[model samples]
Target: EDQVTQSPEALRLQEGESSSLNCSYTVSGLRGLFWYRQDPGKGPEFLFTLYSAGEEKEKERLKATLTKKESFLHITAPKPEDSATYLCAVRGSYNTDKLIFGTGTRLQVFP
Candidate 1:
């Protein structure tokens, strides 16, 4: 059974603070891992796609890295505007359009 799990259901950070979110998965023949950000009432905004282990992508204060069994979203000096729900999803080689998603980690960056 393929599944994705995200840790620390929620996180709260002060402005300028940095942290990382974790996403772990178990699947047969991994294909790709994706990251997304979602606000309170909107759909998830695509962030990154990692195809293999040791792959990484970055945008502004966020950096995403992938390993054989897990992925991490690293935030550097986040601001209040960075507060949102971070989501992680993965696609297995068995399915082209199917994606297993985690429950997400709600992040709050306060000033």
Candidate 2:
């Protein structure tokens, strides 16, 4: 059973508070790990794609790293605009193009 789960369903942080979000996954023959940031009522914006363990990708205030069984999204000095739903997806070798998504962790950065 391939699955993805995100922790801390919702997070509220002050403007500069930094934190890490977790994405735990269980998949057979892992293909890729994807991170996306989504705003309310819109599609997810692509963040990173991790292909193997020890892979790390970054953009602006967010950094994502991957391992065999889990992935982490670390936010550094987040801002109000950085607030959104962070999603994790895993692609299996048997499943192409489609990514199985976690429910997502909603983050709110209050100024």
Find the candidate with the highest TM-score and give its number: 1
TM-scores, each model vs. reference: 0.97, 0.95
**Local distance difference test, each candidate:** 0.95, 0.93
lDDT of 1 by residue, 2-108 (tens): 89999879999999989999999998878889999999999999999999899999999999999999999999999999999999999965857799999999999
Task: Give lDDT: candidate 2, residue 17.
Answer: 96
lDDT of 1 at 5: 98
Q: Write the per-residue lDDT of candidate 2 for residues 41-64, one digit (tens) a residue.
A: 999998899998998998989999
Worst 10 residues of 2 by lDDT: 91-100
Native-referenced Cα lDDT, model 2: 0.93
